[model samples]
Target: MTYYWFAQSVGVLAFMVGITMFFNRSDRRFKQQLSAYSAIIGVHFLMMGAAPAGMSALLNSLRTLISLRTRNHWIMVIFIVLTLVLGLSRAHHWVELLPVGATVVSTWALFRTSGLTTRCIMWCSTCCWVFHNIWLGSIGGSLIEGSFLIMNGFNIIRFRRLQLRGIDPFEVEKKIVKKMEENQAAE
Candidate 1:
């Protein structure tokens, strides 16, 4: 097999794990798991010589991990700025901006939103990633992004149903916040 096929094979495995963790819809663990797997995906992209996708994935992995710890938007803002600056530093075609766009949207969704809102924004980001993957000739990446789009759509619909039934699909976040407050007060 060619080098491209070999790199993409491993990339696909990482993408599967990352995407699966993404849709868990449970708690911060989702992002944490995604962060780990995404680093591997980044390496895969690097092996394929897709610098734009590789850097974006690596940055996104960092973004998810940082977002999990703090709600501060400064980190995301810095990340976005770095994305624009460093991302453009290399001689790249405009098509390379696809990953940057997806990362920006995903940063906002993961850091600034919750529940249904997060899922909605993530769907949009996933669409961008799908296009990026296709453009990069990553067959596995495209397939995983397509599956993520479908799965995220289902989740949004499910969350909406829960909302209609008077349930907060993001109750976990609220609980976490409450617990944090309690801990801070005790301290």
Candidate 2:
């Protein structure tokens, strides 16, 4: 029963994101932001498809593993080993880390974005992830995503305001200048 409701909410959020992305398609700045946020939501889709309830437990275990200074590949190898061994042995502990791995991969990718536009969508991504995870009854580590989501929302809203108020454009040469530069360098 709970799973159904949770899935429904996630579906709605996904829909919201999709609609926003579509309407935003003509806007390049928003597209970049959407790309960044989409990465995070994409991870949520992975988690919701995987272990929706175990997100926190999985992330906690990941945090511990990451804290141990283990190399990423080795850590992944060990994780796989545990999954095959301990997991098959009925040790449920390591099996739950799947969602955490998804979250980490998603969040890490989102962190690579720059610019105010991207900074804004970053929050939406985290919120979308946490919103689903929270419904699954795990609050742990979600705040990290949620906090960034709020900050990003604020930044995005500010941008909308600036744009509406006719913000000044940063000057940069277009194709004509670039072509001249190329011709000069050729000479």
> Candidate 1's residue-wise lDDT over 1-187, tens digit each?
8888899887888767766654565658777886887688788778877787788889888988887766566787988887666566652777778777888788878777766787788789888888877888886777777887888898789878989999986788768856654664676
What TM-score fits each model? 0.88, 0.30
Residue 36 displacement in candidate 2 (angstroms): 19
Best by TM-score: 1
User: What is the per-residue lDDT of model 2 for residues 36-140, given as tens digits with 9 covering 90 to 100?
Assistant: 444444444444553432333343344333422322444544544443443233324443444444444433332333234434444544555565445444332
How far residue 119's Cα lies from its native spot in candidate 2, in Å, is 2.5
Worst lDDT run of 10 residues, candidate 2, spans: 168-177
Task: Summing lDDT over every window of 10 consecutive residues in candidate 1, give the lowest-scoring window.
Answer: 177-186
Q: What's the residue-level lDDT of 55 in candidate 1?
A: 83
